[model samples]
Target: MASASPLIDRHGRTISYLRISVTDRCDLRCRYCMAEQMTFLPRERLLSLEEIALIAERFIARGTSKIRLSGGEPLVRRDIIDLARRLGRHLGDGGLDELTMTTNGVRLGEHAEALADAGMRRVNVSLDSRDPEVFRHITRHGQIETVLGGIAAAKAAGLAVKINMVALKGLNAHEIADMLAWCADEALDLTLIETMPMGSVDEDRADRFLPLTHILDDLLGRFDLRRDAHRSGGPARYWRLAGTDTRLGLISPLTANFCDGCNRVRLTTEGRLYLCLGHDDQVDLKAAIRDGGLPAVDAAIDAALAIKPRRHDFRIAEGSAPAVARHMSVTGG
Candidate 1:
């Protein structure tokens, strides 16, 4: 077989990171992510595990170094560990540099050991609030004890954990300081993300869009924050906390656009290759692979890159439609 080509978008950005959503079904209904009632795709329509592995291998062969398995909740996918282990085979010398995952932590405790054994050095857990009531309110049915237990299990399994908190104005914004302090105490990194206008939820997204700038201003008074030049392969900007090992990462896509350095693309559960999260331009890699094999999959990827938008059109306003109709979970948050 001939060597695969590097994936470079039309704007000259080398795409080395691929986030694949293994499933579109999540257990929690985070207010910002989904509605109380969601209509998920039929399991038969989802790309088979074999198909997912094949597509992932194609990307790895084509110079993609990092692959993050994501989902509505990746842990909920059946036999997901087998798939993780299958993908883990590509994590050596000339293959993928990292195989990681992003989970809501509802099922992390049960799978942490297996995930670690599958060659994942680190994992990102989405935890917005440290308070039980706030956490339950945000996740709807999530129990803080379960998530906390999962985090502990992950730590005991020797996996480096990072907390991903979505900043919401009226909801858990007040808990940012507490979350950061807890992360520090637990030796975990915390990244704050501005609420994104993705899909339609019960409430207006503008009501919950909390600018990281406000949080930063409040934090500066409480903690000594110095700029840190650490790039974690995503859009988060890092700031080293004064005298602690904890680092606070801020992903301010609304207040501060980080599009110029964009090197990532998303693949939905059914094999749609989404070039940008904030936009809906996608290519069907599932069809490509099924109809014409890996070569066709490569062609489809190249075509998708050619049309990759320069920057996402993300805006939050009262009565304004979501930038895209798909939920963040659909695109693999």
Candidate 2:
């Protein structure tokens, strides 16, 4: 922990983890994620793969150690494996300590082995429900079997697999126990994330927003769940299932905020730098890089770090929340 690094924000949070979104395109349109007939980003607007690696290398040089590739679905990006191979060069030999991705798992089954061979360490697959019909309904038309098969493929490829479920109140609350049980049976770590007030989902948000605290309360009442004292670099705080290796993780962005300990930043496919996930504040790094190269990147990073909000000032208070007008897909989940 060097005190002189520019990645340290005003709040004393060191930005070590950088999430790079490869594309804003997705196969399935989830209700909470995007609206029907949502417009996609133009292909040319995205930063080139070479630019992605160059920007990441600059971050690594400045003490950023972990990089996670993300997207509306990363696999949909053309030549993503090539990008993985290029970014992998920034890891582990006094470089990035880990390289990972958060995918919808739509295309993971076919590309898992190649991704591993290209140096991805692990993957977090988004699977909201295990029920086929419910899964299709939630994702607008996604195949549960496809995601399941992809998870299996990732596991077989020797990549550490973790399943992420966006826990909603009236929607999937009843299936919480089923999700936990299934993860245990599959020997996969399960992380239950509370719905955040991002994008235009505010109209039905309050009614649908389920806090992770409530889910934990139910699990604690029904089973012997205890917190694991081990350190996990990510936001989720884990609780191990008694007598088994399967653990439950809770990410409460609304009811409980983790910003005080935040250690990451996000880079959108078009190169907008989001210092916090819930805010609209962004630094146009694409312009910086296009204009002045690495020196511009260094200056932009320092400027963004200086004004990084101490905590996300999300607009939500039961009645109305301003339309974020952006979805997690474009924001890289």
What TM-score fits each model?
Answer: 0.98, 0.95
Q: Each model's RMSD to truth, in Å?
A: 0.9, 2.3
The per-model lDDT (C-alpha) reads 0.92, 0.84
Worst 10 residues of 1 by lDDT: 1-10
Candidate whose lDDT is highest:
1
Q: Which digits, one per residue and each the tens of the lDDT, describe model 2 over residues 1-333?
A: 112354889888888889998898899887767776778888889999888888888888888888889989999988999989987876667877889999999999999999899888789999899889989988989999999999999999998888899987677889988888888888888899877767764246777778778789999988788999654567888899897788888888877778888998999999999888877778988999999988888889899998888787554556676346678888887
- Against the true structure, candidate 2 reaches a TM-score of 0.95
| Model 1, total clashes | 0
Predicted structure with the largest TM-score when compared to the true one: 1
CA deviation > 4 Å runs, candidate 2: 1-6, 201-203, 315-319
Rate residue 266 of model 1 by lDDT: 91
